[model samples]
Target: MAAVSATVILLIGVGVPVSIVAPVPQARAEVAQEQQRATDPAAIRLPSFGSSAVGVVGMPGVLAKRGPQAPRQMASITKVITMLVVLEKRPLAAGEDGPTITLGQRDVGYLDQVIAANGSWQPVQAGWRVSQRAAIETTMIPSANNYAETLAVWAYGSVPAYLDAARAFLKANGLDDTTVVDTNGLSSGDRSTPTDLVDLGRIALANPVLAATVRMATADEPNVGALENTNQLLGTDGIDGLKTGTYDTGANLLFSATRRVGDRTVRIVGVVLGARDHPTLDARVPAVVDSVVAGYHDLALAKPGQVFATYETRWGGVGRAVAAKAVSRVVWSRARVVRKASVDPITGGRKGERVGEVTYSVDGSTVVVPLVLDRDVLAAPVWWRLTHPLR
Candidate 1:
């Protein structure tokens, strides 16, 4: 009886720990996934002739190009540069009239010069007291060559000084391909590439005063009476304003527009250099704007209950790791989207248990979605555990 009792005691002690504390089989995850749908680039329509480029404001590089990247005559678009430079010296807050600038003999001389050259001008006379905003409006709205020269001289002391400042501004802004010969773009030497002008457009839009002044279709100036904007494309096709220029050889336009894409507000900047005429350039701009707007889409990243990984056990238990809810992202031009999944081994758990997670990234933004089990994974039967020792 003593020998039998000793053997039974040893067996009971060993079996109890084996059944209670022994390890269960780990769940094996198989990473099987279906390919995401592919997207194509939009057919962006560009001007048939001349040079053109378009880009989103915050994005890097141009989205579309139709002509050579080499510099071309940028006509009155030079005023945009002039405005940028002058504002650097004489900055103005939005809605502030700034200091009063009294037109003098030099300003009148500027007006006479533009009239003689057959360039754009608004009437200005010596001794006419004008607010700084009015001068800017006159310069930009009517493409007045005289006010441009006047603003340049006023801000930096003379056109030559303004030229020096302009060069500095260009260098600082990375517009290496752009050259400004005079305060106004009247000189054919005023040259820039479609690419550089697009970047310039971004710079102009960033300035609050220039942004507001350029969009005005008409402004009542103290000296010039009611001045009309040279950019007729304003208030059309969502185009607000930038600048316009034309010379004997060709016309050019640096334009900006506000567009909506999937609940996101987008600013688009573009340039058309060497267009045959203003009408032709204006006609092609809408198509370019539309193409850019169409490039953004809401991409579906994951669907509710979509399986990302399959969980299986040696004990004949099976489960699935799935997305808990739908997920999506707003992306531009089919930007490359990438995903990664992380799942943990499991012995058994109830349905809807959080297993792990999946991370998605696109256009420098990230999104995380939780992964859950599709069904409960039952533990190995007690009889099986008792008969088969844990390895």
Candidate 2:
């Protein structure tokens, strides 16, 4: 490249042509893959745990199902819906239990039926009044069958009425494949698909009261007394609220997790149904999650004040175009940063004035950046202008 002379004075009666060219960016053979097969949710290895499915509600929105989509037994994960309906009918603010639900003779009868059937129990007594928050914790943490019924009756006055409300809630929330025949999930009648459960996890975590209640490893309330949460994976590896379920059908788990990558928080909601056992689910769920966490990468396509191209005039001027802002996003797929620069060489331009533009396309999303002049580009000297022959 020849040095553009700056000391040379413009000549009189002589016209000189000026033009500048900027190089276009090149993409590598391995760049911009159609999919990140290595870490894509569909491509990752899943444990053999009968019929299962996995999904994520995120910026990229990923979903994969390896088993049947038909409704299957969801076990105690039904409690998630139970808690959601309770909060929906009687909303609870942060740290607010809303109101007290007094246990009645009917609740005591529910208690007997649950205990006689060998369903989960949290020691509910007749005439015992507990705050709505405590009630949610009771049903969620210990997977209490009776508390679930007690809450439904307390909120809706009867099990049949509660089912009516639950059915509406399911349809309104777009959970078309899920139907709850029993609130406690003790009966095989309550059913959902692995795909539908992901949406269930999303709705459950969206409510503050229910989100906080399910994350507690142990509940120490007066009504429910000391009870441990069924989800043993809570507080591990960014895992938080949600519920777990197990029955003859198999083990199931719903999770809400957050991991930091670059400047963004990547939140993941995952559901897996039909694992061999609790231990198998504990191991397999995280293994599936690890694929997502590790795949998140800070894709820096541009930086503030970074010059992508330059232009020089053959007559006497030079200028550069720089990005005005930084562009970085958390991505799990291929990042192909391709830029097309359209520049106009000017006889004069003010510093910061847009002299060119760049179009950046990542995946299918496109962003246009205005390239501004990095410094003032002045016209040729007055003598050079006046002395130039009129063509």
lDDT against the true structure, each candidate = 0.87, 0.73
Superposition TM-score, candidate 1 onto the true structure: 0.87
Clash total of candidate 2: 1
User: Mind giving the per-residue lDDT tens digits that candidate 2 earns over 1-391?
Assistant: 1333432433311223331122211211111112222223224545666555555555422445566668888889998888788778988789887788788788888989998887888786788889888887888888888989889888898889999999999999888989899788998888888778878887776787887787789978985569898888888888886888888647888777777879987777877777878898888777766666666667766677777666565445667777777877666644455666666656567889886666676666787777777888765554454444341
Clashes of 1: 1
Maximum-lDDT candidate:
1
Q: Quote each prediction's TM-score.
A: 0.87, 0.84
Estimate candidate 2's alpha-carbon lDDT, on a 0 to 1 scale: 0.73
In candidate 1, position 388 carries an lDDT of 66
> How well is each residue in 26-73 modelled by candidate 1, as lDDT tens digits?
888897542334455667788888999999899988989997779999
Q: Which clashing pairs does model 2 show? A: 13-387
C-alpha displacement of 210 in model 2, angstroms?
1.4
